[model samples]
Target: MADQHRPGTLGHYVPYLLGRHLRAGAWPPEIGKRAILVLLGLLAVVYGLGFGHMLGNHDLSATLRANFLLGLYGTVFTSTLLVDFVPSYRPVQRLLPDHFPVSGRRSAELAFLLDLISLRRLLLGVFLAALACVPGQQRVALLGVALLLGATALSFGLRWLLTWGRGRRHPLVAAYAAVLALAGAWLTLAATKSLTGPLAAGLPWLVALLPLGLLAGQVAGLGPQFLNRNLVRPALDTAESQWLARLSPEWKAYLRKTWPALSMGLAFKVFLLVASSVMQAKHGSDSSRSIFYLVFLPVISFTYANNNLYGYLYSLTLNELQRLGLTSRLLVLYLRLAVPVLLLDCLLSAVLLVALFPASTWPLLGLLPLSAGVFLALGLWGSLSKAKPVYKNLDLMNMRNNASTLMNILTLATAATLYFMPWWWVRAGLAVSIMLTAVVPVRRLLSNHGPQRRQLHHRLQSM
Candidate 1:
């Protein structure tokens, strides 16, 4: 009776509430629908271009095809998790029923269905299914369907337990997923005897189906209270969590100033490190490991760039740092913070390299920090040249994205060439020339602090 009497009960109110949320702003449903359509259209174009590239190169290895399919499946599954459960950086948080006066059970069910059966997911499924109809990949299509169902269900249950119910569990859940993925990859490698083989073919299905079983296990334990508890809400704010209390004062300050950007970068960095190490372990031979390192030179270089510059800019953390005065001190602060992490990465990578390469080739490990430094210098150069802070506007943002991508490609091409170059002196000359070229930009960026410093000094004095 109370449910029926309630003015905004889930059944009667949710649709209206959703309508209000959608129509609240200038953006109309047609615009939203058109945006979604355009996005799907772009996905189609991307798939076509990717397929054409593969065909053009005549490089359609089964491993490449399998990995591409798996990536698509993972993308669809990740989009679901991101839309519904993962509370980090959600753009649509304002539109959720949590903001309204809806009752719990109905809201939970509706949210669950909406998250599970989203239009984006459906479109992606249709796209992938059509791709599977390609000459030799019907099984891949079936596997994709199976993965979508299984990963979505599994993420659903995981979100209920790790994200929906309690304190700061989502981060732990992410860590758990990373570890689980690595373990699974290790198991697959062990079973297959090679990274690419028949085992890889069946692994995707198994990976997808395993989650369904995991989801089933949680339901009995969760009981009826699950419905009452499952309504999607904002992730618990860990801004003031004590987890970082034990960090050194400098580290704490760095994290406080950087906030989510630094945290995200660190997570990504860790994942890259793990992935690189795993690949190194798989390729036991010295030549293979050397080649792997050379091939991924740009990747490792860009990992640092992505974590630092990209993350800071995207999260608007760089703007925050600009308030501290863009003087030599600020530059030093960044380098000091970077050095510890860079050293750690270098050490881990060196350990992997040592296991695979001769001691003489060990000097090449210096390239990690060297290239990272070069990119950081380039980032500073770009920032200073604008006379404003980094990542300021749409046009600049587009320029930055394109420039960063082009830089990465050029860096990769150069690294690959250097790897094949026989003359040691030539490699040394190139390295020296690159470093020397970087020095001018780094120096210019450090000195170009005009009015910003005076304002920043006053702000600091006031603080």
Candidate 2:
């Protein structure tokens, strides 16, 4: 009875002859959506209270203000990127507006609403802004937040204004990009320079106000053509088919957007390496142990990128399609790709760590084969035991993922075992034992994989 009253996802579509404009607003599906947001907001407040001391460590007014503004800008900037880019990457999302016939202005409005809701990073910004509130900062943390928001608004308005012009958007895009690049470069240099120079300067706050006039202007909304990527062309749609011949049918099939994950997997390792380096000064080599132990994933990074490489997502092809396929061929196919890439990641990460801490990292070299093997085997099992649909491009928000909490826990256990064991030999032995756990799953997959094939294919058409 309650559901009947709600209008959801274009309950009313006007025909060309009847109504003048189409109604495109989408409401939250259920009351729980708003309830969850309320709970999250409350949780963020509690979290902020807990992290207050770390933020406010430096009591100087200038230091605190600079740090707060920096955190806010970083949060909004990064979160904005995710909101703007993630939706466009989703295969379904790209085609939705195209088919749905939502006007560009309506699409932009919806995007803005989603962007506002997805700005959960504002919570973290507030938490870090506590840095400026410890009684010594020259500028108020609250005021700094306001300034950043204003700058953000002004930038957006200007971006829309510049791009809304006729003809070539390329030149306009280039000019916009150049301005942002210059601004970013200057800010980066200033932050890295002596603290008293830019960190304590009042100039940054004043500079944030540069867009005040633009903020007052009424900017017209642009269409999704301005926001999203050009449509994914069919294989033979263009002359680019020259390169298509070079790739095998299988590669052409799933080349299934795996490189993005692989590239991201490497990026994940790089980030961990940087984090470990920062923590190494304080916690020693213990911090970087993740680089060695968690070979399945360097971070939670690739979990969404698809835990199972290759046909794991497209098991529909190997299993149900093409007169039913063998699991071994699929298994071999998956491992064939996953093996070298992950091991290389592990090796490169180890080598870099070794260069940093030669004596401590030598164990990483010894543990490399065992640790990498164990996770690779586990990844094989993980990829098969549960199935998820394939997508053209990976997005930050995707429902069709095979990753589970248990897998992450098991990966972490590898770190814990290596961490507690003083003897490097014992650690390698444990990894070998861990590798054995994949045997049962491998046997099951070899014998009876029909259910998994079905699972992978389930609702795949919707994606």
Candidate 3:
């Protein structure tokens, strides 16, 4: 009976040990070395400045201190909110079953532990530790930093646990909603000056610990239970065929046939729009909002141009079209494809502006034509340039690369114009510049590289 009980005891501890091993493997070797160097460098700098002397001379006003704390807390909250939705860092659950010959419950326990030791937590810890040495009310500043880090970690852990409990349902949607609510509450508290002195001092330490305790409880017991249940169920596949198939009827049918490329383009646009809106709503001041609008307009326009270029290039399978004796048919097909994409750009820009900033409707109405012209030029150029055309079919990776490059160039140009001129006229000029740059070279390249035909008589004589 004692020997039989031993196996059950060992099984309970298996997840904890496996989690530690997995974390050790996941962390990059360079990160540990760099973290050590950074910590040492920070210590040396603080000591050289005479930490006590610097604190004595610190001129941080009450307002400055309050703002710094607010910013720090806001950053932590945002990071916690985004952690679960981070596409690249998602846990490798599929790999777990192969590596660990254990029950799903044990496997999940290990995954939870691995997540606790994630790079995100380590970086947040480093940032908080560095803040402790900053010149301020030493005890208050240190305490504040500690509270912020603890709260952030707790929030992150809780979010992950909830996600697992929900069978990993759209965590990002919930996270975004939570973040918005928190931001609203913080603003209200700040405006009322209720977030000061006693309330601030007492709340940080206590409130921070609550989440930590909750996180520990969830991880220790509930985590394995949720994981085992979730693992037994069939995984949810997000891949939708009907939506992708609908795109085939559109003018960009040739390109849309490559479902992956279409999906990626749509996903990227949605992500950018959502992220920008969330940031603007949470952090935008009067001055910052103005700056944001100025920056955002050009950035969105550049993105529109890049997407147009991608669609155009994807539709034009130059090598394949060259073999078919149907020059007129191919040209007609290209024109049909270009028209709808150009129109879509115009529509998307109008809708996005209205959705994000309804007050900017008049400005957007004026910007639409300019945007349309720029998109047309980009699309036409992309179609004309036989350079790296998607011959067999659309390749998502290549499309991404091409789109990124085009967007980067356009964005840089917009930036330069804004720096030198910084006016509506300058923005309009930038739009015109993008059109000229794309149109002229592309036209010339296409004319030169147009499909060549060999006479049948000459081919027969050579044979």
lDDT of 3 by residue, 1-463 (tens): 5563342133545556656664563343567645654675566445434533444454957675565556556556555444544322243342253334444444544555555554444555555555455665466446545555454545455455444545345444354345356555754586456887776666556545555555455545554454433434333435545545455443344443344443444454555555566655766523234333333333433343333343334333334344653244444555566556445545654676568754733463565566556655554554343223233333321333334455445554544444345377866887788778864544443444333222211221221
Q: Choose 2 or 3, whichever is better by lDDT.
A: 2
lDDT of 2 by residue, 1-463 (tens): 5453243232243232112221111123457555654565567666555444445566647555555556555454444434333333311122134445455444444433333333333444444364454554324455455455544544454444443434125344454455356446546755565435544455455445444433332324234353344423223435557677787665655444565555656665666666566667667766666553453234332354335553334644444434653356666666666666666767677766666544755655655566567667666665665444565465443323435446656656765676567897787778778778778667755665666555544533334
For model 3, the stretches where C-alpha displacement exceeds 4 angstroms are: 1-57, 86-95, 98-109, 116-122, 135-188, 204-207, 226-229, 232-245, 249-286, 293-295, 298-368, 375-409, 415-430, 440-463
- Assess every candidate by TM-score: 0.58, 0.66, 0.57
Lowest lDDT sum, 10 consecutive residues, model 1, at: 389-398
Q: Where's the lowest-lDDT run of ten residues in candidate 3?
A: 454-463
From the highest TM-score down, the ranking of the candidates is: 2, 1, 3
User: By lDDT, highest first, what's the ranking?
Assistant: 2, 1, 3
Residue 392's lDDT within candidate 3 is 35
lDDT of each: 0.50, 0.50, 0.48
Q: Give the TM-score (vs. native) of candidate 2.
A: 0.66
Candidate 1, residue 283: the lDDT equals: 57
Q: How well does candidate 1 match the true structure in TM-score terms?
A: 0.58
Instruction: Give the TM-score comparing model 3 with the true structure, all chains together.
Output: 0.57
